[model samples]
Target: MPSRVLAVYDGSGIDGDLYTRVNRWAQSAPHWLDELIKVWSAFGLGLFAVFMVLAWWRARGADSAVMARVLASPVVVVVAYGVNSVFKGAVEEIRPCAQIHGSVALETCPGTGDWSFPSNHSVIAFAAAASLWFVDRRLGWVAGLFAALMAASRVWVGVHYPHDVAAGALVGLLVAVVLTPLAGRCGPLVDRMRAGALRPLLGAGELPLVGHGHSAYRAQQY
Candidate 1:
């Protein structure tokens, strides 16, 4: 049976040409480089997970506000993915590998009904990167670079058009920008958790001692 065409937008014009060019380049690239990109395109998201765990571990020693933002990174990625899914379903854009004739993908082409307007991998990666920005600037910069590479890899692997990854990156960034600040406001909740049985997860170090009675007051404030 033929796959249904439900796309409201088609990128088989300029985007298709660009994809073809990239695919040609990939075909001539070193075997090791292609293999590396294919592997990274598939599993690079795991690095973002590691980054998040590191951020969480480091935030444990920081104030509750910082910790709250770190904790919200995963949530931001989830929300961004959900939003990107809605776009994929609505746009219904077919994968470049399927839409472009005579195109060879480094990775296996996704099957029918798997709409591919905005790349999910791109969305998750950029969302994590943006969310991490609210937690730690240096770490966020590293994640941001990885996120860009991840987006490009999707196209290099011949699964997505340039526009798809670009739109996905935009969606992930917008969602994170809007949600991360609100997430940071959950500091009071983090404080409550620290006071309860979750202290081991939230607290990384002993509270600093202030002058006499002030130490207890400061501890309660955090």
Candidate 2:
């Protein structure tokens, strides 16, 4: 069937045209490549979950400033999700697969009424990567790399359009940038958590503790 015609923001129908071409390309790709993209699209974000744990583990026994930043990562992600949700509601674009007739997406089409202007997967992945960057530049770069791939995978799997992922990535990065400084101001609270009963479980004794003034991005002991 011919791809369904949909109206774009400018009434140019670019969104429909691009979605059809991209979806066709994905359908024609190799079976292995298609499966790989599908797997990554479904499960790749778990890598970042591991990164979150590792970030906390490495920050154990570190100064309050560093610890605070690491702990605040999940919070930043939560806030980013909220921001993504707001954008989705405002834009209200349906999933590309839903808009296009006879779409052969690698994954099953998502249920109706789920707007797709900004991809939630991209939002979460980029948000986690961006927050981790503030904690450890090296590991942050690794997460950022995967985050980029995750964004692309969403389009490759035919669930989202390029613009949807782009908007999501922007929202995720913006959320991290806007929230990190505010999270930094909570150094004292982090210090208290470090000194409390959870210290051992948080891997405090695994490494020597470092102390410094509460400057959010204080030099690392490592």
Candidate 3:
């Protein structure tokens, strides 16, 4: 394992204080609620996966542009994770659970060299939420709310500092914002794929024709 970048500045100011406060609350909170957050912090990401599938299923009858974005949602999440990893490696910030003294994390502290400046869970959740926004507004809102909860849960479980989740959320949102439009541009490609052997995966329904030119094929708000 590579040497952890020693903590030149461990963000022990307000961030560490907030983490300590939350961790302290967790210690005093009801056992069931603490366990619930612990479980959610670890596994709530699965719900986002289900949301993506739901978005794809709903977009099947929409225009190719919409389908393209729905397909790209997972890709956006993967890319966001990759981007967040780069930040993690660059900062090499130690996990708060490991750095803060007298702190008790519900989740086990990650081993050394597993830097934690940006929470990977937060990145994946928010990226999925932002990508879904381009496909359907209602689904987007739901996913976005869940994303926030996921970010908070990381701190509640005492694995990440507040700044880590905030930065991760921003990275995820920005990545999706940049990539979703480019993915939307893939409508023509989706259109082509839908007509071929990929039809079963893309959708069986014929593409909806709306107006003149490409505007007819453009994705619309749902």
Candidate 4:
């Protein structure tokens, strides 16, 4: 992944300099700023899950297409995270802070073997962002902005290099772009499951009406 990203950037001597500048900023930043970055990174890790569930909850019973995308959110997140983990395992690239000297990371370096080729936080964030976007453009844009912030926070905390987060974001976006359409393709399956035993659990109940024919319109549209 790093090699591919480097290729994409044509070895433009920027990755290293970017890392150095970001790390330097992290080192010299005010204490409160460091604390905020740390908090943001930690919050970023959980924020996607919150957004995904909220999206699913809000889409209950309206627009089958939207619900389908919402339902697919978990699958997108899991698959993207799994792919990121596989890359981490295969590459086993040491964390930037561990490799660079005089790197004052805001957060403690993870224990050895915590490979850092691509940023998991970025992967999950972008995956959720894409999923949310598929369901609703407005919400998707908001989530996408948050995803960008989360990616930056990973770099700000000195846990991920720019390339790492960039690759991760790309991986996540690709996964969503490829798989979100499954929501539309799997319309029959989602419809079948609507009245199944897990209906209550999945919140397969009627949602607040939108425009005319809300639920009826969704059924026919999807």
Candidate 5:
């Protein structure tokens, strides 16, 4: 279980400036790049929650079966946050922001409490993308850019390690791959329940050939 935080705590630090080599290049970026990075990071990560809610709202339509499947994906995205919770607390990996270099202009997290393991930002961002990917590959491309921005911005912000973002991305993809079809499996039952196409939402969890591999939805149906 993710350790419950009674109050805010200071973030942890790296054992040493282990990535001094990489830092050299990271510091070379102009001020505009960093500012742009921060902005993109905000959009990439922050907007994911917004997207899911919007998608959920937009998902309501004539095909309830599709809606049920589509809705299931965001639910998995929500759940993946929980899954990250378990390992994130257990791992206790320090963030890069705590490292404190002269170039990286970041402050202590103003409100977002410190708990960086698998990048929840990356996970949700990608989850949002994967959900969209299930609906349309073109939009999925945009989602991919957004997810990548979230990961890169974390590094630029000096808050999360590259590996943290990588893990988050994988987790996000995993959530979609696992959840998409699981929602689909209920298609027959959903159709039966509504007696027809009730709402026209896409299948919620990742559909095979949509995001990541595996068909958890298919497995559950039988």
Candidate 6:
């Protein structure tokens, strides 16, 4: 069945070409808003880094045995990105904002491929968020909502269509559900590792606790 989104794009109602709209938006890309987006994106990255530092901090003085589990959980985040990348490559669906929209908003776009299938943003964010959950369930749920907001924001901004958001949200949720649990199971072992050699690192912890009680990253994970 052809996607109704596709049908909408194919609809004859589009009054102008995407390029024309993009050109128009380019004329008014507010300096502050553009800066805001860049800042938010950067903030998210910063938060993620903070989390990793904290993760290491906690298990710093723990037993080496827990290292495997603790490390594996976060490593799963890497795998999550790989999975999302594969799916993104597989689906070349154009971004909704770029498709049949009479005018494309250039400021909202990266001037990249309109291929907005399952949102990579959604998938990757959830992956990292979910991975953290295994360490702390409350944090996990919070991260899920956080990730969801980010995904929804993409759609709200007109860069992604409703279906694009839907697909991305769905994929992200699926990844969280499947991969996160495995990471959580490593909790005890991770705790053990944190108590041993990793302890010195935590005892001597210098890096700012990004946000969470344990670490900046875990409480306010990207």
User: Top model by TM-score, which number?
Assistant: 1
- Provide C-alpha RMSD values for all models, in order: 4.5, 6.4, 4.6, 5.2, 8.9, 9.4
lDDT of model number 2: 0.80
**TM values, all candidates:** 0.89, 0.83, 0.88, 0.81, 0.66, 0.59
Instruction: Give lDDT: candidate 1, residue 7.
Output: 52
Q: Quote the positional error of residue 194 for candidate 2 in Å.
A: 2.0
lDDT to native, each model:
0.89, 0.80, 0.87, 0.78, 0.62, 0.54
How well is each residue in 1-97 modelled by candidate 5, as lDDT tens digits?
4555322232323322433434455578787876777677666566766665565565543244455556576687787778777767766555555
User: Candidate 3, residues 103-206: lDDT per residue as tens digits?
Assistant: 98898899788878788999999999999998899999999999999999999988899999999999999999999989999889888888899877777444
lDDT of 4 by residue, 68-123 (tens): 78888889989999989877876677777777777767888876688776889999
The true-versus-predicted C-alpha distance at residue 206 of model 6, in Å, is 22
Candidate 4: segments with Cα more than 4 A from true spot: 1-14, 196-222
Model 5, residue 108: distance off in Å is: 3.1
Ranking by lDDT: 1, 3, 2, 4, 5, 6
**Angstrom error at residue 84, model 4:** 1.4
Highest lDDT, which number?
Answer: 1
Model 2: per-residue Cα lDDT over 9-85, one tens digit each: 22115466776777788888999989988999999989988999999888875656667788889999999999888
Q: For residues 86-139, what per-residue lDDT tens digits would candidate 1 score against the true structure?
A: 888777887889888988899889987787888999999999999999889999
* Model 6: how far residue 89 lies from native, Å: 2.4
What are the clash counts of all predictions, listed in order? 0, 0, 0, 0, 19, 26
Sliding window of 10 residues with minimal summed lDDT for model 5: 7-16
